[model samples]
Every structure is written in C-alpha cells, then in structure tokens.
Target: MKFICCGNKGSMPVNDNGIPMDTKKETEAGEPKYGLGVRHWQTFLYFFALTVAYAQRVNLSVAVVAMTDAAAANINFPEYDWPEKTKSLLLSSFFWGYVITQVPSGQLARKFGGKITLLTGLSICSVLNILTPLFADWGGWQLVCALRVVEGLCQGVVFPSIHTLISTWVPPNERPVLGTCAYTGNQFGTIVMLATSGLLASSSAGWPSIFYISGGVGCVWSVFFFIWGASSPAEYKRISPEERKMIELAQASESTSEHPKEKLHTPWLSFFTSPAFLALIIAHSANNWGFWTLLTEIPSYMKNVLGKDIKSNALLSALPYFAMFCMSFVFSAIATLLNKRNCISTVVSRKLFNSLGLWVPMCALIGLAYVDADQSNLAVILLTVTVGFNGACYLGFQINHIDLSPNFAGILMGITNCVGNIMSIIAPLLVGFIVTNEQDVEQWRIVFFIAAAIYLVGNGLFIIFGRASVQPWNDPPAKHRRNSTPQVESQH
Candidate 1:
C-alpha cells in the first residue's frame, strides 16, 4: 500500500498493506484533513450530540440555584422553597435511571443500530428538558426529580451508542483522536452549561429559559443527527470510495460487505468473569469517584470554603472543565504517536495514560487539601490542572473497550459506565456525610484524601490486570487466536 501526504491528526491515503501515517508532527499541525471521509463528519456531529446531552443533563444545577431566587420575581419566574434534602434528591435523581439503562442500551445498540439508538435517546431527553420547568413549577420538586430520572433513562444510551458506532467506523490509527473528539464533549459541555445556565436564568426569561434553550438546541441537533448519522461507513451516503476502503483496511475484516453482521448474543458471563474487564470497572469507578466528587461539589466549595461570589464561583468552577477539554486533543495525539511509532504496545499506552490521568489528579487532590482560603489562587490552579490531566482518560480505559471487543464495544461501555455511574452516585452521598459542615476546610481535606486513595487502589489493580487485546468471545467467526489482536502498525 502507498501513503499520501497527511495533515495534523488527519488520515493519510491508505491502501490494503498499511494504516494511517504517523501523527507526531501531524497533530502539532492540527486537525487532519479528510476531504470526503464521512467518518470525520460523524465524529464531529457525535461531539455536538454529546455536548447537547450534557448541557441538558447539567443545566438544572445552575437553574436550580436561580429557581429559589426571589430576584427573578420581577420576571415571570417564581421562587421555590426546597429543603436541602429535597434539593439533594433532585440533583441525584438522574443517576437512578442512568444506572439502570446501561446494559439494556448496550444490547439495543447491537440489536438495532447506533444511529437509531442514539437518536431515540436524544429525542426523549430533549423533550423532557423542554418540559422540565413547567413540571417543576406544577408538580414541585417531586415532579422535577421524576422528570430528571426519565431524562437520565433517555440519555443513558448515548455513550454506548457512540462506542458501537466508533467500533464500526473509526480507523484504528485515528480512533484515539476521533474518539476523544466525541468523549471530551463531556467536559466541554459541562463547562458551557454551568457558565451559561446562570446567565440565562438571570435574564428576563429567567430559570425557565435555560431549560428552553438547552431543550431547543437539543431538538435542533437531533434533526441533524438523525439525518447525518450512519450506523457504519457502508451506511454513510456521502463517503468517498477511497475513505470507505480506508475504513475497510482499518478494520481488517475478511468481509468487505457494506453492512455489519448482526450478532444478537451478549457474552455477559464471560464479561463478568474477565479479570481485565473487572479491572476496567474498578478504574472507571475510581475515576468517577474523584470526578463526580469534584463535579458535584466544586461550586459549593467555591461558594462556602473560598467565599467567592456567584459569578466568580461559576467561572472558577468551570476552569477545570475548560482545561480538561483542551487537554483531551493533545494527549489523544500523543497516544496515537506512541502507538504508531511502536514505542509501546496499546495496553502499555492505556496504562501509561490512565496513570497520568489518575495519579496526577490524585496528587492534585492532596495538594488542593493543603491550599487554604489564603491560597485560593493555587487551589484553583490545582483544580484546573487536575482536571486538565483527567482528559488523558480518553486515551485510557475509554478507548480500551474498542480494543478489548470491537464487536462488543457498546456492551463494554455500558457495563463500565454502569459501574462509574453508581460510583458517581455513592461519592456524593459519601461526601455529604464527610462534609457535615461545608464551610469546614478540614473535613473537605478528608474527602479529598478518600478520593486520592480510591485512585491509588484502582490504578494499581488496572495496571496489574487490565487487558487491551481483544477477547476470545468477541468474534466467533474470526480465527484470531487468544490475545492475538493485530494492531494498526507494529512499533518494531
């Protein structure tokens, strides 16, 4: 196979004998040009979908703050008298539904198609988001909690669908960068949602406007998503034959058929018993413990511990996510470079990136605990850098699912995400008990220490046990031997 000239993070012209070119100097140049690759378009649109998904998911946190404000009385909005416990319930309600749908969504994505599964999820969420304010006012916090749970049910299929589609479409060489493009939307979306929710709520349109805005954008994006989204390269209408052949080469599948073979069975027992999969669950759960702890409490900490005003707190709290989003692309490129150059195996690269993602944040948590109110600037920077490093997770366990089981990527994502969502739930409840007085800095230190410890243990187990090679059960038809998944390019 011959290679063509490439751009940053871009695919090179490919023939049967080779994969995409090295991305070392390429990523430095920027997004690689893929003129007729619908794969690139799909990745970009998936990023937008996830951004809208998170915006709908998190707009409530900021909106709820303004929801209880009498300052909005001049507008049509009414202040609600919600107890702390009720407010907590409202905030935590989404995960109740989120945790339940993972396995089912994974199965559905396989049985049906990712494009349909994702669109269905997003459609349900956007409608719920639009109706949230009206329901919250009419039925009160109870209704709001119920609605959030429903929204979670709708949104739960998102990542699994994305994973399934990626397994079908993304070339192995560009998977890290393209996958990061989609997944990093989590950080980028949260940052935008938190930053803008208040501004929308404070406007004459009031708290209701944030919901309206998020829901409206979601609805619009859904239309585009349904039209442009394809289950596989074979299904994509506009992709050039050159790009389609590249996709075929990337998968190295014996069949060049347009449609993926339908496989109805999920290897649930095999998955549960796998040490490698279990290791991922541990790592994913631990990452969520730290991430969710910071996500749920950062604004509160900014308000209570550091005594920052609302605007300052919002922007400062958002800084970490902003840093995280920007850092995602850089490390994704590095992971691709490392693997492309044969410097390390894919498994080693996952561990290395996962270590950087987990351990740096762990250390940052420890450092943050020592930074008092007098050192608030350092505290903010610590938090920013911590989350920035967290973005390396895209190159870690996040994409490891595809490596472990391209045929079952959706299932793995769902199962691992289930574990993480449960951890996300538990972390908040654990933190609630730890920080009896939110104003107490010492108590918060204990919380940070607990998160760091979780990271320490989880990363340790993963390094010891995680497997990046495809599992034996993934493709019954293929004759690949155990632990013999061929990589895109050999380092040697």
Candidate 2:
C-alpha cells in the first residue's frame, strides 16, 4: 500500500499488490468522496443521541444540589433537607438499574438491531425525565431515587447499542475518528448539563426546568432518530448504493454476507480467562471510579469546600467536561494520523494513549487533594486539565472491544460496562462514608487519593495485558472458517 498525505484528511493509503487499503473501505475510486455521506450523517445522529441521553442522565446530579440546599436556588423554590448520606443514595441509585440491563441489552441489540433497542430506551427515559419533578414533589427523595432507577434501566441499552451500530456502520479505516466523535457526546452532554443546570435551578422555573429541558430535547432527538436512523448500512434505505457497498466491504470481516442477521454466540469462558479482556475490565472499572467520583461529587465539593454558589459551582464544574469534549477530537485526529503513517502498532497506540489518559488524572487528583478553599482557581484548572487529557482513552480501551471482536462488540461493551458501572454505584456510597463532613478538606482528600490509586492500578494492568489485535476466539471455527475474516489493511 502507498500512503499519500491528504492534509487535514490525514494520510489516504491506496491499494497496492493484491491487498485492499484503508481508503478503499469507505471510498472506491471514481465514487463520491466519503465526506458527509449518509453513514456520516448516521454517526452524527448517534453523537446527538448520546448527548441527549447523558444530559438526561446527569441533570439530576446538578439539580440535586439545588433541591437539597435552599440557598442553592431561588428562595421561592422548594428545598429538601436531605442528609449527605441520603443525597449520596439518590445520586448512586441510577446505577443500580444501570448495571442490571447491560448484558441483556447487548443481546437484545444483537438480535433485534441497535435502532430499536436504542430508541426504545431513549423514549422511555425521556418520559421518565419529564415526570421527575412531579415524582420528587409527590414522594420526596425516595420516589426520586426510584424514578432515577427506572430511567437508568431504560437508558442502559445506550452504549451497548451504540457499540453494535458502530461496528456495523463505521468502516475500519474511519472507526477511530468517527467512533470517538460519536462517544464524545458523553462529555458534551455533561458540559451542557453542568453549565446550564445551575442557572436553570436558580431561575423562576426552578430546578425542575433542568429536567424539563433535557427531557424535551431527548424526546425530540428520539423522534428524529426514529424517522432517520438505521441500525446498519443495510437498513438505511436512503444510503447511496456506492456508500453502502463501501461500508459493507470494510465490515466484511465482521459479517458472513452483506448483512448477516445471525445472533452472535458469546464466548463467556474465553472472555473470563483472556488477560486482554480482564485488563479491559480493570481499566474500565478504574475509569468509572475516578470519572463517577469527579462527576457526581465535584459540584458538592465546590459548594461545601470552596464555598461557591450554585451558579458558580455549575459553571466551574462544566469547565472540565468542556475541556474533555474538545480534547476528544484532538486525540482522535492524532491517533488516526499515527495509524495512517504506520508510526506505531495498534497495541502501542492503545497502551500509550490509555496511559496518558489515566496517569495524568492520577497526578491531578493527587495534587487536587492538597488544594485549599483559597486555591479554588488552581483546583478548577487542575480538574479541567485532568478530564481534558482523559479524552485520550477513547482511542485506548474504549474501542478495544471492537478491536477484539467486531461481531461481538456489543456483548463485550455490555460485559465491561456492567463491571464498570458497578464501580460507579460504589464510588458515591464510598464517598458518603469517607467524607462524613463535606466541608472537611482532609476527608475529601481521602476520596481523591482512593480514586487516584485506582486509576494508577487499572492502567498498570492494561499496559501489561491489553491487546488491540483480534483474538483467535473472535471468530470461532464452528461459526466462521479460519482465515475467512477479511482484514481491512493490517490495522484491523
């Protein structure tokens, strides 16, 4: 293959000898350029879907502050005097339901297609979000926790379904850039919610407005996706024949024919025993511990320790995620460039990026542990840089499931995410125990230290054991002939 620099488009490698090259997967010679094709449009929808889903998921985290503290919102708004332990329970309740559906949702998406699975989950979550305020008023924090649990249950299919869709819709050559773009919606949603929820909570409409707005957007996005979304290239009736052919050719290794509808048989034993898969589980769980701790606790930390008002708390909390959102594109572009230029093996690239994402946050957390109320500005900057660099992991362990088994990417994500979210459920409750006094800097320091230590340990395991290359069990002999999988360039 010959690599030609395509400027901002990166290197476009052309087919040489009898081998097909990366560029050929999405763009055939004499075909329209792969820019803004229907597949790209579909990916954009996936990005929007995730953004909407996460907005709904996190609105409560910010709103819970205003709901509990009368001074956090308009004086006229209702406030509950829930204790810190109760608040922690409310925050962590969502993950209780979230962990339950991960494995099942992946199987459902595989059998019925990602389109139906994702839309069903989103639509239900939207209705539940819109009704959250009423439930909180009627039944208090207990009811609110129940409502969140149901919402989490409905939204559980989101990432798993998206993984399945990506494995089918995205070509191997474009997966790094496009897949990262789609998942960056997670950070974007957090940014939007954290930025706006504060102002909305203090507005005349009160904290309820936060829920209403996110729910409305989710509902609208669901309708849009229902009308336009396709589970795979084969399902997209509006896709051009050339574009469809290109995507199918690129995904040939994952499917038996143009669009194989068979439900994949997961190798449960192999997954449990594989060092690479176990490493992924640890990396994912560690990321969740740090991520959920920062995500769920930052606003409270700003409020109780730094003495920031709700509005300032929201805006400052959002800064880190905004940095994270922008950093995702930078990471993806650099990863794509490196892969295109043949500057690194897939294993090297994955490990290098994953380490950067984890170690920087570990150091930042260690430093953040020492910050006092007077050093709030320094604290915010450290948080921003920490989360910003965390975006590098999108190219790391986040997409490693597809690298291991495109055919079972959804299943892999479900299994790993299940384990990870269990940590999400634990992190908040653990914080409740460790930081009995939210205003106590020493207590908060322990929380940060634990998160940082987990980050260090998780990345260490991944660096030692992670493998980006396709495993032998990815395509079993009974289901697929050996060597039948068509590798899209050596990068696959």
Candidate 3:
C-alpha cells in the first residue's frame, strides 16, 4: 500500500507521473468538515454483507449438532439419526460447490462490476438459506447437502467480488485500515452466529429459526445494497468531486490503464509461475486447514470431551471469534502505524505479522492437544488466544494480493481462495477419518498436531519466498498489451 503525494498546478493537482488530478480541496468546494464518504459507506455495506453471508454459511454447523443429538442440546424437536460420517459429509459439502466457482466469479466481477455480481450472488444465497429447513426436513441430510452446495456456489463469488470492490474503491495508503476493517466482518459474523445459534436450536422455534432469521436479514441487506452500492468511484453518483479525485489519484500510482475498468488479459502463466503467488497459496491453504478444522469440529469437542450442553457450547465457541474480531482492529492499526512510519518494509511487515499469526496458533494448538479433559477452562482460553492472534493474518498474505497486483487482485484472490478452500473440504473429511471417537482426547491430539505441523511448514515457505512488491506482469510492454476495451463496452 504505497502513498501518493501530489503537487498543485493552478486549480488542479498533478501526480508524480504527470497525470492531472481533478479533485478539489474540500474547503474551497464547500463540503462539510467531516462526514462518511461514499467509500466509507461502501465499506460498511460490504462489512454487513460478509456478516450475513458467513452466518448463513456456518449456521448449519451448529444446527447439525442439535439436529443429530437432541440430548446434547437438551431439546427434542425432531432429531435425526445421522452417522458421524454422514454429518461430516454434510459439513464439507458446502465447499464442494464453493471451490468450483472461485475463478469464474473473479471473471464475473471483472466483467459485470463487483456491485451487481456480489448483490446477485448474495440475494440468491439468502433465498437458499430461507429454503434450507424445509429442504432438510423433506430430503434429509442428502437434500440438505445439495442445498448447501448451491448456497456455497453463490457465496463463492463473495471474497473475489470484495477484492475487486476494495481495489477500486480504496487507495493503497488506506488499504491496511479499511481493508482489514472490512474483513473483520468475517470474525464478527462468525461470533454472532455461533453465540446465538445454540439458543435458537434449543428454543421453541428449534434449529429452523437460525436459517430463517439469517436469511431474512440477508435478503433485506441485499435490497439496500442493490439500491445504494457502486462498483467503483467512477460509477458512484453521489460522491463529492474532492473525494472522488483523491481516490483516483491514489489508484493512479498503481493502475496501469487511464481507466482501470478497461478490459485486460489475465496473466495466468505468470501467476502460476511466481514464487510469491505460490507462497501465498500455501499460506492460504494452511490457514483454511486449521481454521476449518476448529470451526466445524469444536462444538463436538465441547459436547463430547467437556460435557457442555449446546447453549454453553455455542457461547464458548464464540469467545475465540470475539477475540479474533477485536484483535483484527488492533493488528491492522499496528500494521498501518508501522508502515506509515516506515518502521519496516512491506515484505518484512507481511512476513512478521504472518509469522506471529500462524506461529502463536501453532503453539496454542500444541498446548490444546495436551489439555486434560477436566481442564475445559484452559482449553477455552487456549482456543480464544489462538484465534485472537490469528487476526494478524488479515494484514499478511490476505492483503498481499493487492500489493502484488492491484490490477488483478480479484483474480489472484480467486485462485488462492479456490485452492485454499479445498483444504476446507478436506479438513472435515480427514477429521472424520482420524477422530472416529469424538470423545477420545488422544485422537483429537492427532488432529491438532497435523494442523500445527502444516502451519509451521506453510509459514516457513512464505517467510522464505513471499513478496509484496508489484509484479512486472501487472503492466506489460505496450507491444504485448491486449485490450478488449470495446468488448466490455459493447456488452455493457
């Protein structure tokens, strides 16, 4: 995230590259002293959308426990006799569809603009969430798995579209603060859903209410975002001239084209060959493996090993994510302040934060693996600290895509996320294979050790090879440039 300083030329300001800036001074333009800009509003909307989207995704995780084991929840509202294997299949099934569309979703965001693409996907997923309970009851676990697949397909577009939007709306200088803030919605959403889902499952309305409430909120949010959201500063109708120009200049130092919306070819070969990108893929995949392992299985751990009822399980599970949410702000602010003051280079900062995030969790998981069954409080505290420190990752490989290539941040994210989510699909299935007895602490120890080892190996590779500087492929020579500008125009 590089900062751009511009010099004034008469009423207009010019960037170092000799590009004329069209933004006005707010004082001269009679704008208010302080107010939320269009970008800020866009960030808020994005944050909430992520919140609802994640709640919809993970609601099934908690609900499934109540659905399968009524005694664990201390409620009996039509429980099913699902085997552990079947439950695992149902849990991982979402990622089966999720990974398939990642690359294509990036292309969609590039073609149609992120606003429409994101809104359409979120709207469809919301509707699917609303229909989930009925489908589960009618078709059983198999049908529920199928429905989750479709929901996953729709949600596959989310992160890529968000990357597209952030690259366009937020400048490099603001990336750490605004980008991390936007993504913290992930932890916040998880905390909200996890904390409430157990109570919902145990209430009179039963597990069905979880889906109904989340889906309804998502639908309402979709309508509002559709009415107000803009794909980029150029597309925003309500932006003041000064703010718009500031964003444009901020991007001018990074984007190759005069108009970033111009259609450009994706450098697939470079992406695959680059050590930096490959390192990012490794880190992303490793994080997903550990993250999803805990995400899908911790509830069972609480019920089986710690003897917690469903309500207590949900609340305790949410504590780690709450820590994650709070620490995200802290981590991002620290990164921003350090970078602003030039305390470290971008690559070093990336590695340092990433190491802290992954390494601390690795240590915690090792300790978690050895916890006695009676020390449930210690287990909860370890898990909380593990997730809390993991928030530093949002400032690491997560934002490195934008640093590497602002032009193709969406595509880079898509590729890594696609590969990364494969781990999400695999982690649960492997857990099903390894931890056959959910109550056996020793079997769970194997799971923790494997996750920690992967964390160690993955971060080691990233520290050795990961890069944060812009890639040469982001702007090829004029002779090699392939612009389908007219294609985008004609289609739109």
What would the per-residue lDDT of candidate 2 be over residues 1-492, giving only the tens digit for each residue? 111222216554332322113233334455434544666667888999999988998898899998988676987888998998999999999999999999999989988999999999999999999999899889999899999999889989998999999998988767888888899999989999999999999999999899999999999999989988888878866566666887887788555423344534467898889999999999999999999999999999999998889999999999999999999888877777787679998888889989989999999999999998789899999999889999999988999999988888898999999999999999999999999988999999999999999999999999999998778667643344456545522222
lDDT of every model, 2 decimals: 0.80, 0.86, 0.86
Model 2 Cα shift for residue 462 (angstroms): 0.5
RMSD of 3: 6.2
What lDDT tens digits, residue by residue, belong to model 3 across residues 312-398?
999998999999999988887787678757889989989998998899999999999999999999999999988889999998989
Model 2 C-alpha lDDT versus the unseen true structure: 0.86
User: How far out, in Å, is residue 230 in model 3?
Assistant: 0.9
Would you estimate the TM-scores of all the predictions? 0.87, 0.91, 0.91
The runs of at least 3 residues in candidate 3 whose Cα sits more than 4 Å from the true structure, single-residue gaps closed, are 1-35, 74-76, 257-261, 477-492
After TM-score superposition, what is the CA distance of residue 394 in candidate 3 from its true location, in Å? 0.4
Candidate 3 has its poorest 10 consecutive residues by lDDT at: 1-10
lDDT of 1 by residue, 402-455 (tens): 878887899899999998999877777777677877789999999899999999
* Pairs of residues clashing in candidate 2: none
Candidate 1 clash pair list: 8-26, 10-32, 342-491
**C-alpha lDDT (0 to 100) for residue 201 of candidate 3:** 89
